[model samples]
Target: RVRNAERCARFATRSSTRVKHEGAVSTVQVSVLLPECSSAPSHLDSVLNNFSSFYLIKKLPVYELLDRHFLETAVYHGAVFGLSYRTRIDEDNCVALMPNGHLTLSLDKDSFEILGFEGKPSRFKHRTATRFVVSVDLTDSSMAPGRRSYLRLLTSLKSRLQLQTDFLLSHHPGGGASIQPLLSRCDWSQHRPEVNCRVLTNLPCPAPLSCDPHSFLEWLGAVDAGISCENSSSSFLSSFVCPEPNTMHRHALSVSVSGLLLPHDIHRLLQELRRYVEQPRLASWVSMTVRGFADSPVSCSNHEHGFLRGGENFYTLMMFHDHTYQLHLAMGAHDVCPP
Candidate 1:
């Protein structure tokens, strides 16, 4: 829960910033310096519509997810993506429903022992096995309903530990209908990812094409945080300022979407963003920033993900009107660097 708390705190800080901006949006980490260009905005709004939506299932038994009827309809199809809600990998027995038909359990020592499933020590943070990772392939031939191994797992989850959590669930093309069987048995609420946009006038922006990544990111954060670079030397609250040799934009656009975001929708957004940059306009570039789930058991490219200092995992993409672009990816010390 520590990871979740820390994430919440960060989000709270973001909330304060939003109030300062009167509800305008601030993306996690990224900024593009618009160079003089010609382009018209078209269908840019459709990108927001394509983003995947997710649902929250309250107090759901972990075992219930193993229902044969549900598995056959969703999991076996390799379209489901799920993870326990409000769970922090650094301090909780988290569950993950992977798209590849695997149910991953990252459990503590006692819970791992009770589950009775074969698993290896977690390679996150600690070298020794303070925690463990058990991944069961629901798609394996031996995992068919009523099989010995399947029954063993069923009993472990249903009768032993009785693991239950608020699960964040989503499926590809089928979406909600794909997992209706499971949702029918539990209390649930559906939610669409929320989007916020802010336009900054007389904004100071750095030349991303030339600025060092570190400094660029810092400037991006300053803008997102609404920190005043106009502070006088004697000002006490903050003395932050835009990077040197920056140019002023009469207007700069910042757009962000937050929630149980999916990679497919993000890809489509990128496609739309590219279209946005290709049109004739006055901005030099456009960008999209993505923030990963704090409680996720996996990060970009499906690598094992863990939380250390709030699990700082995110990336920024800047598309230039010149047709050249740069992608900057980062996952702080706790995760395998993005692929």
Candidate 2:
């Protein structure tokens, strides 16, 4: 696993350099979240509170200089570094100590676990860091399992380190309900899909807008039309309006499609829409009422069909109806049909 992590780190470094040379925005800002610890170390705590932990790699004189300093500092402190980076809107760096006690690095490819800890291992050939935002997690193991301690420790180091720039501590959820409320209160401009999707998925639609539902439907249809024109194979798999009689309430509608569209394609579209929704320049009155389905079937006829694939056609229709009905209940505020 360690070997794989090294490989990933190397790849990321290379990719980052390519992006930089391409004249794209090369600077990335990272916010580290640390778990609360009962007995935090003073040096660690000092690091956590400091703001210079974030640094720009471009400002460094040489890669070897920084690499040597990083290694020496880490070894002197007897700590393991959990490397992370932001590549694109949906892709971000995340490394963890897995449950089985192996170090795993999730770096744009399949995660790799570290196999050994000693000796001068082969360096993963990649670009050097331009800057770093480090942080540590120090929550007690008995209270917080996994590498929460490591995360907390990193957070602390991130705070005090003067290597790059200031460290930003990401918002951490206290509980299930806490997430939705926190998301609701966030400044959308600061929302990154990779970091916030899990929270957003659980959040209920915010208070509905006062726009005409029919007008909104028309706009969505036009957008769908444009998408279809751009990609001919795409089709409106299924779409329906809520049947409930409530006219004052909002409605939830979905359209499903199946084609050559891969999961990555769908994900890209969703990410684009998310950015649009977060745009503060847009009118606050405008709201996004649609969600895309990619990897998973948009609508399934029967719940059982999901588990059994023999009657695929029949179950697919059933699932669509089920989803349609549920939308009615949630948006129209009436359980008029079965989801």
Candidate 3:
């Protein structure tokens, strides 16, 4: 039976890829039957068992003809693999697996014809048969969007066809990990469900949820500012921290700022942030976003068009200072003083 199955498989292989794409648009219908009992494994199983049995019967001539017919049509359509038969048999029951995993027992061949036979066994008086239909399509990465849409169609069909199970596995033919990030930073919120954020056993951080980017940064900054005083360095920094680091740093600052002003302003704000941490004169930098500046008393005149004109404009200004420190390489120590 296995040898016959292999022969049948070889015969069917020719049309598998083509049928997978074109589907059973014009195909033969294959049918199989088993005992009529409620305890029957399933109709699909019966159909598969019947096909396997026929293949094992040394019915090479019929199998080869059917295989050739399917392959010829599939090749005409430029298919890569042809549909092959899959079946499993237990002591008293048998089951068949189909490419599409449909629950029916009628297979539609490429010629839009049905094939199979009916049989009854005494041990398993009750039996059922399941049917499967398939089609093939091209595999081109350039058609990724189209291929994705096709896969989605398959998913829908699996539900509508009432298949027992179906899943999609994608692969690159050349076999290398594609380094495109699985999920984009901006789209993380949207694709979060697809992300596997499970905690592994014996991990350094068992309560991993608490170690996200925001919390980690906050923890680091707090420790740097001496909020965590368990360490000796934290205690020293807390005691020696200067109150007017911002003012002293601002006096010594020189910046060559040129870019989209928005980005330049952002860069300046970042520099101000550095001064808050390193300068003896600045303790903190305040960041703010102001809108509707035309109504403010300190509004500057727009060169191309005055504020009173119809055109709309906006500006972002960032103010910051500089911090100068002396490095003592021998002692690995530094001195923070106003620039």
Against the hidden true structure, what lDDT does model 2 obtain?
A: 0.22
lDDT of 3 at 34: 12
lDDT of 1 by residue, 1-339 (tens): 243332111111211121111100112222223334222244666667556777899999999888998888888998888889888888998988887888889899899999888888876745567888888899998999999999999999999989999898877865567788788889999888776656677887777766877677678767766776887667898777777778877777666667766556665666666766767776667765566676677666656777766676666666676666555666655455532
- TM per candidate: 0.84, 0.19, 0.15
Top candidate when judged by TM-score against the true structure? 1
- Model 2 residue 291 CA deviation in Å: 10
Backbone clashes (count) for model 1? 8
State, as a TM-score between 0 and 1, how close model 3 is to the true structure.
Answer: 0.15
lDDT score for candidate 1 against the true structure: 0.70
Displacement of the residue 267 alpha carbon in candidate 2, Å = 18
Better of 1 and 2 by lDDT: 1
Candidates ranked by TM-score: 1, 2, 3
Whole-model Cα lDDT of every candidate shown, in order: 0.70, 0.22, 0.21
Task: Count backbone overlaps in model 3.
Answer: 51
Stretches > 4 Å off in candidate 1: 1-42, 125-128, 232-235
